[model samples]
Target: MIHLFLGGARSGKSSLAEALCHRWPGQVVYVATARSHPSMAERIELHRRRRPQSWHCVEEPLALARLLAEAGEDQLLLIDCLTLWLTNQMMAGACLDQATEGLIGALSACRAEVVLVSTEVGQGLIPDDPMSRAFVVAAGELHQGIARVADRVSFCQAGHPIPVKGERP
Candidate 1:
């Protein structure tokens, strides 16, 4: 099953995803897409501390499709956030269309249950800059695409989750 969680910053989407993963019976693998930077050190540490040591962690900013395709049926995959992956792809000038297509295909073929976390960045004011506007549009479109393929979707606000599709988990 593909489960998607969307929310603004600090809205507890990651926490909700983690909680679900903890309920899974098999191994849990955390696929982290965030690039390490000094400014993000504390935030990263907090997440690291929160997750159980038994769960394996893989830091892959790109090539998520490959990882997903390789996962076994005995595992549950939790991708903490897609926004950072998108940002990395944009910064590297990767072909977004191809990447998104590959991701969708991989998700379709994946054997393990997957949980995806992403920021809902399109609800705020319109950005004055072209790049920011483009990012917002891309993120909104990405969310829509994922939602279409996902078995379950939830929106988090103020640390509360509201089910958008499927039953509340």
Candidate 2:
């Protein structure tokens, strides 16, 4: 099963995704895309501490499709956030279309239950900067693409999840 969870920053999307991972009767693989930069290193550590120790962590800033392909069938894969992954790809000069296609293909072919968490960045005013605007557009498009293919989709607000597709949690 593929589930897409969307929320704004600090909206408890990651916690919701982690909780859903417990539903799967298999090992959990947490794919973290956030890089530990000097400014956000403490935030990263706090997130790491919140996750369960039993869940295996895979730090992939890019090449999401390859990592998905490598996961075991008896494992549940949870991607913490797609925004960071997209940012990494953009910074690395990756072909956006190819990367998006590759990720969608991999998600379709993977046997393991997959849960994706992403920020809902398009619900605000447009950015004045070109790069920021481009990122917001790309992230919004990516979020839509994933939601279309996912079996379930949800949105979180104030730590409360409201089902947008499929049954309520």
Q: By TM-score, how accurate is candidate 1?
A: 0.97
Best by the lDDT measure: 1
lDDT of 1 by residue, 30-116 (tens): 999999999889989999999999999999999899999999999999997899988888899987777887888899899999999
lDDT of 2 by residue, 87-145 (tens): 99999999877788889999988888899999999999999999999889888888878
TM-score of candidate 2 on Cα atoms, chains taken together: 0.95
* Positional deviation of residue 56's Cα in model 2 after best superposition, in angstroms: 0.7
lDDT, model 2: 0.88
Residue 6, model 1, lDDT = 98
lDDT of each: 0.92, 0.88
Spell out the clash pairs found in candidate 2: none
